[model samples]
Target: MSMDLFSIARSGILAAQSQLGVTSNNIANVNTEGYHRQVAIQGTSTSMRLGNNFYGTGTYVQEVKRIYNDYAARELRIGQTGLSAAEASYTKLSELDQLFSQIGKAVPASLNDFFSGLNSLADLPSDLGIRGSVLNSASQLAQNLNQMQSHLSGQVQQTNDQIESITTRINEISKEMAQINLELMKTPGNDAQLLDKQDALIQELSQYAEVNVIPLENGARSIMLGSSFMLVSGEVAMTMGVTTGDPFPNEPELTYSLGGSELKADPAKLGGQLGALFDFRDNTLMPASHELGQLALGIADAFNEMQSQGFDLNGELGQPIFTDINDPVIAAGRVGAYSGNPGTASLSVNIDDVGALSGSSYELNYTSAGTYELKDMKTGAVTNLTLNGNTLEGANGFSINIDAGAMAAGDRFEIRPTANAAANIGVVMSDPKGIAAAAPKITAGTGNSGSTSVKLVSIDDRSAANFPVTDSELTFTLDTSVNPPTYEVFDVNGASLATGTAAGTPPQISAFGFTFEVDGSSGGSESFTFDLSFAPGDNTNAVAMAKLSDSKIMNNGKSTLGDVFEKTKLDIGSQTKSAQVRAGSAEAIYNQAYARVQSESGVNLDEEAANLMQFQQAYQASARIMTTANTLFDTLFSSVR
Candidate 1:
């Protein structure tokens, strides 16, 4: 009995001490991230038998375990992933939104300044300085737009860097978790320290990707990312790429592939930070930048055309207005003689002098012996002209065209004619918006409210049969929607269309010297532009260039530039709001799961204190047993003496 008592006292003391340690650990890690409170599980010892009678031994320690709910842990992990994605998306886009707000300031009053310079010239029609200033402003605005674009592009590059860095971080975490999981398997059943390490790692992981947990028989964990396991059987470890070469997709396309199998996930359908980046590039940034380009082009074309038509200080016709579009290469193209001749020559057509433009007329020529016939680029037709004393004379009033296809990259055209010619030619450009004469004032709608008031803005000759000549359909583009809208098109001579919306499955339109099918449809109508140029003899009273500049041609007499920018800003706002809402919902779900899991698995101060009391009491009872055993042994030894 004494022996049994001594053994029981010894075991109870050890068990109580272990329980106290566990409870202490629980209290210590209460505020620790990813810490799961532990429990000291105890079980009764086996009954000791001697002869027919049986006697029970004292209680013994069974195991030290975590009070975690696996289900809750899984839910918490998934929620964390979604929340991380949302926050990341919001932060990045907000930065971009702030950047875009500086557009107007960076290129302050571009069109206004250009026109103001013109007004100055109109006052002093023969001032070279003013003429040069006007040209400078026009070119300067173009440069400003180019600079702004460069800045936006830099932002895009930075986003790519962030995405790649994040991916690489995710991979690092995955590899560490995998390695830790293996080490844990060998470290005697559920090492609390190791468990804490792994849980901490997983929680950190929630910041990047969505995760799924798999529990093994030995309390080890493996993880999955949206169905495909990122970790498996405590092995086959994978490292995620936090950084990649180009993280931001230029066109913002999203696709998922598994062993060459492309998954059907529209980037829009994804609900994470990654998805937000895709949406920004695809729907917001890309679209806005292109529109910015269009705005720059429109202003350049309009102002340049007007300036070229007006007289400089020398009363010479200005050069063709700035290009409808330009590139790094365009600035290099020299204003030169349009004659087909290989030898150098000069042009004296200065349309800038209003009086001269009123009666200005000439032709161009390019021949093997000298400058004679040059093709008009605008019309891609031949121009006829005769050169005399550095001045050019032509038939047909000097209307000419230059063909893009006919010219080579380095081909040069000499405008002054001589190596050091004294005279030069005027500017040539066509206005697409038709805003030269009118400052503001869109014509009021005579049609019904639902009737679209879309006016033609511009169109390139991308092809003969294709309407609007662009990738995306415009209002003027023929529609093949199952129920097509009934609208009038000036180019197709008022042709109407109707058909199913499926692309290439067509009922078609036959007009504009070509028969083309109506394919695909959109929720809203599109728009296009047409050329209605103003000329001197055409009558200022008629549909002349000056007449269109009237306030009536615009929306509420506001600059077209203002209208276009405002519309685009509204669209971008909606997209950002949508992202915020989605992210909020995800966060709410994560919080709910986290709380539930914390209730079961998280440390509790009061609970730990109470456990300390219970274990201490058990230890006291065991100490009493030891004292009793010693007393009995002392008595037995005294009897032997």
Candidate 2:
């Protein structure tokens, strides 16, 4: 009986020792990250039967189990991913917003200053200083646009660098995960520390891209991005790579592979920092850059065309005020073929309607044999086109002419008409004397015997006007036989053109490039003559240039230049604000998930301390039983002797 008591006391002592060790371990690692609380479970030992009665044999310790909730872990990962994406998006968008909010030398401000300079020139049409101011303002505006485009390009490059860096980190993590999977398969479900490390690694990976973890047999896990872009499966890890050889100011394409087979996954499927960066680069930054280029191109082309129609102070046809894109298509106005494009077709594009242009890039690809597809990168709208002998007419507000080459199957092209206009624009006319501020001259002839006076109005159509090779004279002969004196028009050769009863109205002249207004009536049998001559001091062209500030010349003439810029600013502001709000919400959700994990698996020092005391007392009692059993056994032996 005493022997049986010794066996019972021994089991109690061992069970207490194990429980105490577990309690101590919990207290020690209370501050350790990713460490779940552990508990030592004890069960009753096998019974000993004597005389048909079963009795317990102290206790046996089961496995030390770590407290973990897989659902909470998943929620925590998702929340953290959301927070990371939102924060990344907010950071980039805020930078863009601040960039557009330039204090004085911003694009909009420079544009306004340019118009103001034009208005000043209109007030003093012949002043050289004012003309110089106008020229300087134009130059400054072009400089401002150039600076903006350069900055945006820099940002794009920076974002791409970050993307490559992030991808590298993700690859490293995935490789580690594969290594861990191999290690775990050797001793499945025994390495609690290894499991903890794997969870931590997964959390880190989620910051760069969406992660989905699937537990397989043998306690191994597979890491996937988006839906099926597996990073790791069993002991294999897929590698990620970035493709290069594209032009500057554009991001390289992303590539994925498993072992050695190349894989393609849509970037949109990603959801963390990687996804946010891709979205900012493609959706926000690219479009905004293209829109700015569009504005610059539109302004330059419009002003240059107007200046061409007028005469400078030197009485010569004005030169181009701004150098525009050479062919109004492709990035930097240069044709682009896909890096691996299977085509030799060279493309040229013309802007049929500037106002109809949208701030978007396009993708041109061959759908099949002798067929092409045009897609708007921003909207994903597709337009089908037949080959039509290498000309695509009236598509997307532009005409595409393909020449001197043939296309192979699966060829692709990228067209960014307005993406680099700002960078390419320049002040072509350096001389202030080249600024056109005068119109064709008109004058009234010296010989007239009537109360009627004539003044020259605008020459609406300069191309159709038949200006005489030499000075031409227009004579108005009147007849007082009618109540309202009738008049007959005669050219320089006295050839009668038209005869009509005169009234108080302006009459358009077919011979000259102008119209005339007669305020007073002609006397009986009187004659009036007028001639057209050059006018160097005219401000009509300058005034017309100044009016472009308020003209609806963008968005199919539905928006002004200022309106497009304002919309851009507002869009950036709205995106920044939305990202901030989403970040806040995601942070809150992450905190809550963390709290849930903590409540379920976190160690409690006070509770561990209490457990320590209980186990200590139990240990002491079991030791006392051993002592008592030993003493009783010694007494029995002495009595028997």
Candidate 3:
């Protein structure tokens, strides 16, 4: 019937109009970011029966469906997060690498110059001009170390500032996300624009930290940061903040709070820009600072020890050429107490042997009364050390002394023996006469009838209980009446200090921190005596100090001063190279993921144009149906009239 025809034509027209509208919308928003292509779905309407024969009722639009793939979006987010982290790490590490590569050369050059000055002084021990030059070189080396330490400390502070700024932005984003969730819940139908805005915010948030999105039945979403902390839930958001860390005031820690309750976020799980900054500060920057400090400590302490065992131009015992290793301020800074400690315990660290230092930090935790455990921060090795009275001795190259109060069982302290050495090191001796260029003891033959000579090898320990005091003499007499030989040693007061058989390859005698070689091969009675007399022209101590440039006195006697600096440089270079490689790989992955997402959900102008033409043609065809049905209705009316 004409009536049925009119109804069918009307339905067809409505369906075509809907399709045309959808196509036009897609074309209009072709360049809009975060807009997904939409499609109008068509379905057949209910049929009509007349005389046992069914007839179609044309078509109607079912729904306008958004084109999106959740899986693809998730993969894109993951790729974005990885790329952000890699790039952040590479940027920071490259700066450090470049710093060490450029300014780092000054340290090695200064070290060489200092040793060269020492050699020049050794060639002419009594030259005041040479001594002054040596002192000048020494001062230059200290200044270089101080400058390097200042730069490294500045990097640490900059990193902390970045962390704080990022945290504030994250908190702002969290609040905005909460607002979006509330809007989604209040909205009745699916708001395509609102959903697009939500997704855009999520993508932005992923740059700072890892994010996990969860969909709710009420059309709202929940966002989790680092896959653990809930950043947004329904209408509420958690706040993130940074605070000064315990034990180390320069370090910063991340904190989370919600509804007045504080929560802790696992630092390792924060794998994005935030995580990269934290890693750089803790692993790369801090370790490099410590290594440089260790090198400074080794140099300063070695020279100071040599000075202590020699005499100056005025025949006085030499003082420290650099600041004292155990100065009160320096010692107290080596230990950091945890802020949560209930006891009033205070501790100080003293560098007992510079050569034995490992360039690592340690954690001291009290387990019981007068009992503690020391853990190496680098290697994670733990050692049990018991407090003997007020001191704990033999800790790597250092000793811990209780300065005041007692510690509770759960108290903890961070011990960093060499962390501040570079910053605190200085050239304390200004006078050229203070340089120790002569040996403390002078040896000679006491009316010997044999071809024998005495040469002082080294002063092993000046603090030995039986060591001779200053201005004292030691006498050595050899008796060949025995098969091999026998020796007797006596102090200045005619008291026998030691007696032993002088039987060796070259026949040497050791006593009271002094090793002397007595060659009695020309078979005759030999006698020698050594007196504590200052020889200003002697270059014995200067020669020994020059040898330190090549001496393996660091890293438990495995690395020299130069070796330590080179090793530190190599470590930073290696890390920078690794970060660059990782960043390249991440970029490749991110590009692939972005392409996939664009293909799946992104709008295409060409495709949308084609769809628009198809829908337009369909609209024209449906309009023709309406025209035909109207004409047929007019013809039926005329026939009836």
Candidate 4:
């Protein structure tokens, strides 16, 4: 009986000691992150039977269990992923929003100053000082655009850098996770510390990408990234890499490899920090940059067109006030060939009409021989275009000229007509005398006219072919005797060149790239003569250029230059605001989920202290039992002696 008592007390003392050790460990790691509170589970030992009566044989610790709820953990991970993405997007967009805000103020001011200078030039067309000032303002505007484009490009590069850094870290974490899994498999029983470290790494990894953790029977975790790619399986980890994108080298593409198989993953669908960066780059930053470039192209092209329509102070055809819209380098930069293309085919894009620019990128894919499909990146609208000779004219304000080798089927290109316009735009004309402030043609009344007047709107490309080499005159006569007024245009030798019936309202006539608007409300025979001479004092072209500030010559003649910038600013601002709201919501959810997880698994000092006292007292009681058992054995021995 004494032996039985000693054995029972020994078991009780062992169980109490285990419980005290677990409670002390919990107390020691109370502030440790990712440490789960542990408890010793006690179970009754086998019973002993004496004379058909059973007696308890004390207790033993079954296992040390970690307090954790898998469901709560999963919810916390989801919340963390969402919060990370939202915060990442908001941080980037807020920077952009601030940049545009500053740019929004500076650009419009410079634009207004440029236009004001043009207006001043219209007042004094021959003033050299005014011309120089106008040029100065124009230079300032161009510089502003160039600076803005530089900033946007820098943002793109910065995003790429961040993606690379995050991906590299993710790869390292994956490898570490695989090692941890291997260690877990080799470990004999549940190693609480190792499991804690595994969970800690998992939480850290979740900050970069969305992760799904699967528990294996061998006490190892198999992790997957966003439900598709397995980052870690058993003892193997997939390596993640970042590389330049196919079509746009400035952007980033994500790739992963497991064993010998390599595959590409879309960063936009990754649903974490990586996804946020890609989404902002493609959908927001790139689009905004394109819009800014479109504005620059529109302004430059319009001013250049006006310059071509008039004569300079030197009495020569006006030179380009800015760089040529079709400069070889600039044009070639507007399109990018996909790296996956098997063909050496290359193309150049030329802006045909600034007003028709969509301010968006288009995908040109070669489907078959001499066949292509153009897809609008913004709207997802596809248009089938067949190659006509060596050119493919896009309905959207641009034309693609095949420059080199032929393209094989499945070849692809990305055409961004205005993407580089802002960066490449410059004031090429430095001479003040090169400013075209005079009208190319002088209009005068010839014969007795009833209330009809004609004025030259603009001179087009055919003006050079139609105008005589020397100073000459063209006669335009309108005869109202016919049902619809008949108009005749005559050359310098009095020989009729062309005759036609004026059909449209407020009758107009177009000849040799010269469009003349005839206001004939008085209804009578009218004749006008156009003197093909340069008038340096004429400010007609300058006046027309000044009016361009209010012209709706962007977005298919729907927006002005200022309107485009404002629209871009508003778009970025709105997106930033939305991201902020989403971030707030995500944070709230994350906090709630974290609270639930901590409540279930977090260590409590008060509970641990109480447990320590209870186990200590139990230890004392079991020790007293041993002492009493020893005393009884001594007594029995003494009595027997």
Candidate 5:
């Protein structure tokens, strides 16, 4: 009986000791990551033989379990992932802030300065010094654009390299994770080290791109990239690659096809740090460079074309500010380039707006296989061309393109038929055609009416003046004295040509396609009237009577003839000002999210210390039971002796 009693006491003591041990362990490892508090479970042992009443064996350990909620663990993972993405996005976006902050002197600043210089020139229209200043400033503006374009192109190249590096990293990590799963499947239990390593890897991977992770039966996780690349599956990894910057400024883009395989945007998916960088390079930085290029190209085209009309300074015009892209379509399409012409009117190429063009001229020359390239003179960024066009419902310039997808917002462009020389007309039309013979597109009627007639001397058909490139033109000339007189040059249909004054000097003559220059006449505001004309689609006008005293001009100073040239210049300084503000806001949001997540997951030593006390008391109580059991056994032995 005494032995039986001792056995019961001993069992109780052992059970209590086990409970204490569990509590102590929990307190000790409170700071250990991924360690859930464990509890020792005790149960009554069964009797070997049952008679009247079955009250037999003492106690036995049932199972060692965790004092954790399964639901809580799942919640933690969900939150962890959310935080991971936020943190990753924030980290990646931070780089954009840095990049934008660094984009100086060439972008917005130069743009604004360029226009301001134009304003100064307009203020002193006849100041030779100011004129030189205007030219120099214009040239400087182009230089800034070129630099900016080059910078953006560089950024694109860097982004592509990053994409490659990111893909490689993801691939390696994915394979490692896959292997871990296989090893885990063969093993009896989970390997904590593998789990931690996988977690660390996931955190790292999230920085570059967003990912979807699925846990397999074997304790392994499968990784996918942007629903595109199945980076890792069943212990295998598929890698990704990238093509660097475009070498041609006017071309579109080329994808980094994976060794002649499909374009892998998955492992190379544009997201996380990669996405922000891509956006900056393509959307922000790249576009800015392109705009700079556009501005440069536009001004160059304008000034060079005008130089043929004879300006104030140099005997001849200088070279184009930036180099043209190597593409035949540029000189072939609606916005085709013009070389030389002796006609009184020369060609004028005026872009409707810079925002209207694709990232570069390459979109017009997208390759059949959907591979094309264009160099960014600013950031030197290169990107793959998705799609684009100069007109709505535009054709698939490249066969592998979506049909006139969506026009990017802020886009603007137009190709008005222009003349070739200062006094040369480049409109392919020599006269109205096909509609009414011996009739004109526009006719002049005497009155207070603003009707001006367009006369095409050698009419092609004289019927359909409602067109461009038909070789029909109005004959005109310029004066070189004070300044060129402003003339409203009209088309065959009496529609305005791209706005500018008629040539102002050297009394040049043209049989066809001469540029409109200013007339050096009474007050430099002469209006040369044309004869009867018809047909439509012309939109050119003289520098619409630029009067500084006009209240409209003083209020905003834009959209008018005088301010037209000024409006088109770059605005680098203004752009930078706004970019800095945007960067600041993004930074704040990132920091806040980061702080909130850390507070919840981090360890607190003070809380653990408090838990230690409770476990110590339990330990002491269990020790007393062991002493009582031994004492009882000794007393029984003494009696028997």
Candidate 6:
């Protein structure tokens, strides 16, 4: 009987010790991150039946179980992913927004000054000083645009660098998580510290990307990204690599391997810092840079057109004032096929019309054998392209020429017609006298050739279709024998556009982009000649060019040059504001989800303190039982003696 009592007491004491150890451990790690509260499970030992009466033995400690709600923890990780993505996007966009704010101060101001100089030159067409000022202003404007483009290019490189850094960190974390998982597999359950480390690493990983954890055998988990692509599985971790579509590396592309199959993942859908970086590059920076390029192209093209219609001081046709602004940017895809002897295909794109430019990038894909498809990156509109020999035309306002080799199926190219136009723009006119401030030729006629008083009215070239003619000589022959004094008009090509009688309230005649007036004529053979010459004081074309400031030449003929810049600014502001609002909302949701997790798994000091006192008393009671049993044994022995 005494030995039975001792056995029961000894078991009770061991059970109480375990309970105390678990409670104390919970208290010790209460403030530790990812630490789950633990409880020591207890069960009664086998009982003995004596005389049909059951006798109770002491309790034994089972195992210590962690109080972790798996569902709540998963929810927290998901919410944290969203919050981190929003925060990352907002942070990057804010930096972009600040950079774009300088647009008004730099490019717009320089453009305004350039145009103002042109207006001044128009007022004083023969002033050499004003011509020099115009040239200087143009140089200044081009310099400013180049500077801004350079800054934006640097930003792109900086963004790529950030992506590289983030990817490196993600790889490190994945490797550590895999290592922890492998360690966990060895001991399985009862490894609380290892589990804590694993959970903490997963949470940290979620800060960089959206991740999902799948429970595997032996208390190990596999971390996944975007519903697929395991980042860390069991004892192995897969690494993501960054590849740029272009050599400049404006946008970062993600690549990974699964079962020896390489696949590309869209960074925008990935979530977290990596996703946000891609979003900023593709959605914000690329478009804004292209718009700036569009503006540069528009300005350069319009001014050059007007310049071509004018004559310089040397009586020569005006050369291009600025270098080419219509060059396209080409990017080769990482995945493509090459064939033939040359093996490589070269594409050259040139803008056909500024008014018809879509201000968007295009993807040229060799879909199948002998077939090509073009997709607008902005609108996702696909157009079937016809290959006309080496050149592909009739798309948007541009043409692409495959200058070399043969393009194989599955080959892809990114064509940006105006994305870098501003960066490459320069003032090609070195001499101020090269500026075209005069019309190619002034309207002139033989003064009073016949009895009819003939005078040059006004040349109207303000119409979009009515452009100034580059004529060296035009002849107008008058026959005054008729009652109304009929006259025949001929252009520089000697083509008669108007003949017979002049009919109008002002008795005007229109021909060769000009109108003529005649009054009081009689029967006589008269001839008039309009000659084109380099007149230093001619400002006809200059005046016409100045009016282009109000013309709808951008946004598919819906907005002017100034309007495009204004719209770009507004777009940046709107995107930044939207990101900020989303970030706030995401933070709120993450907080709620995290609070739920904390409530389920977090340790409570008050409860642990109460448990500590209760366990201590239970331990003392078990010790007292052993003491009483020892005293009874001693008393029995003494009585027997």
**lDDT against the true structure, each candidate:** 0.52, 0.78, 0.85, 0.85, 0.42, 0.77
Model 6 score (lDDT): 0.77
For candidate 1, give the lDDT of residue 83.
85
TM-score (C-alpha, index-matched) for candidate 3:
0.85
Tell me the lDDT of candidate 2.
0.78
**Winner by lDDT between candidate 2 and candidate 1:** 2
| Displacement of the residue 299 alpha carbon in candidate 6, Å | 1.9
Model 5 shows how many backbone clashes? 113
Report lDDT (Cα) of residue 554, candidate 5.
14
- Residue 205, candidate 1: alpha-carbon lDDT: 68
Best by lDDT: 4
Answer with 2 or 4, whichever has the higher TM-score. 4
Task: Kindly list the per-residue Cα lDDT of model 4 for residues 1-641, writing each as its tens digit.
Answer: 89889999999899999999999999999999999999899999999898989999889999999988999999988888899999999999999999999865677789999999999999999999999999999999999989999999999999989999999999888888899889888888888898888888888778788889999855689998887688898789888898778777777789988668778886756788988888999899999999999889988999998887777887665778888878999999989999889888889998889899878899999988767899998899998775767889655788898999988999999999988788988999999989999865545454555466665554554446556323567778787665467888887788888888776666667676566666654466777777646666889889999999999988988998889888999999999999999999999999999999988899978888899999999999999999999999999999999
State the lDDT of candidate 1 residue by residue for 541-629, as single tens digits.
Answer: 21233222332322223445444445556655665676689789988999999889888988778888999999999889999999999
Using lDDT as the yardstick, the better of models 5 and 6 is 6
lDDT of 6 by residue, 1-641 (tens): 77778989899889889999999998899889889888999999989999989998878987888787888888888888899889988998888788878644588888888889889988998788998989998899889888888878888889889888988888898899888888888874658777778888888888888888899876689989866578888899888878765423546678876887767776766888788888888788878888888888888888887776676766455778887554333212211222221236777786778878767888788767667788888999988888877877767877778866777666777777776777878889987787777764433345544456555554444242323344446677777676556777666677775676776844776666556676666567566665444578888877887888888988788989888777887898899999999999999999999889877788889898999999889989988889989999999999999
Q: Candidate 2 on 1-641: residue-level lDDT in tens? A: 89989999998999999999999998998999888888888999889899989987788897888787999989989988898999999999999988888631388988999999989988888899999989899988899989999989998999999989998998899899998889999884657787878888888888888889999766679999977588898889888887763533357767789668876557788899988998998889988888888888778877886786566887555678898555433422534677677777777666656778887778888867867788887789998865555677646656667855877778787777676788878898878988988654334445545466544433444443444323566677656445555678777898886777645434433334544444454554656565434366888888988999999988888888878778878898899999899999999999999999989888888889999999999999999999999999999999999
Candidate 4 has what TM-score? Answer: 0.88
TM-score of each: 0.60, 0.83, 0.85, 0.88, 0.55, 0.81
Q: Sorted by lDDT, highest first, which candidate order results?
A: 4, 3, 2, 6, 1, 5
In candidate 3, where is summed lDDT lowest over 10 consecutive residues?
A: 516-525
